[model samples]
Target: MLVDDQVPIEEFEGTEFPSPATVHMELRYVDRLLHIEGTVDADAKGVCDSCLDDVERHIHVDVDERLDPHSDRENDPFGESNVLAGNRLDLADLAQQLVLSDMPMGLRCSDECKGLCGICGANKNTGGCSCENDTENHGEPKMEDAAQ
Candidate 1:
């Protein structure tokens, strides 16, 4: 069987999906097992962890799993896909799980992002603030003395 469709999912773990995810998959039944293979693509919008900037990401993931009517999730060495509920696959849950799990931890706008200034509460990447942060000392020690 050929499955090609788009699924609309609003949010996952605080991250927002601005567009519907495109799924192109093929399912084949062999013996008592069902094999599923697909590719999922989506656009995600979120906040940068460091600078609090609006971060957008394009996610593309590959899915490959096999399911059966009787598969053990516990106590057995081998288990089918966790997206399987009862005798059918849960497409919505599958999309959310795959995308969220593949998402990066502590998403950032860039590697060289300067982030925000703790003293003046200003964004350093956007030309920085006028606060005297003791630039001569290389860090907060100079700012401490300047404040005193």
Candidate 2:
């Protein structure tokens, strides 16, 4: 079986995608096991961790799992393989799970991004702020004062 659909981002909280996720799924039933495979593509929008700027990132994830419809708690307590629910499978939920797992821990506009200044709340990448010099000597005492 094959499925192609768009999953809305509203289903997930604290996550935003430029548009609905494109999901392509393929399922094969062999003996008592069902093999599931799919791919999800989306452009996620998030705030940069350091600079607090809007950042858009493209995400592509692959999914692969095996489910045993016959397995139950008594026989498979640990659930080595996922169990199917009735005769229906929720592909949207599965796609969201896969995307969440593949998301990066932190998002950045660029690797060399200069984050905002803690004192003046200025974006260092755009331009330097007066507080830049002040923060440089915040912790260290002046040599003349220390000597006195």
Quantify all predictions' global Cα lDDT against the true fold. Answer: 0.77, 0.74
Q: Which tens-of-lDDT digit does each residue in 58-98 have in candidate 1?
A: 88989886777456333333443556666666677677777
Q: What are the per-residue Cα lDDT tens digits for candidate 2 across 1-148?
A: 9989998654234448769889898998988777889889877888887888888888899878887867743566556343344556656666766777677788787888899988889888887687876655863567657889
> Which structure among the candidates has the greatest lDDT?
1
Q: Candidate 1: lDDT over CA atoms?
A: 0.77
lDDT of 2 at 113: 82
Worst 10 contiguous positions by lDDT, candidate 2 = 77-86
Record all residue pairs in model 1 with backbone atoms less than 3 Å apart, i.e. clashing: none
lDDT of 1 at 135: 65
Query: For every model shown, what is its TM-score relative to the native structure?
Result: 0.74, 0.71
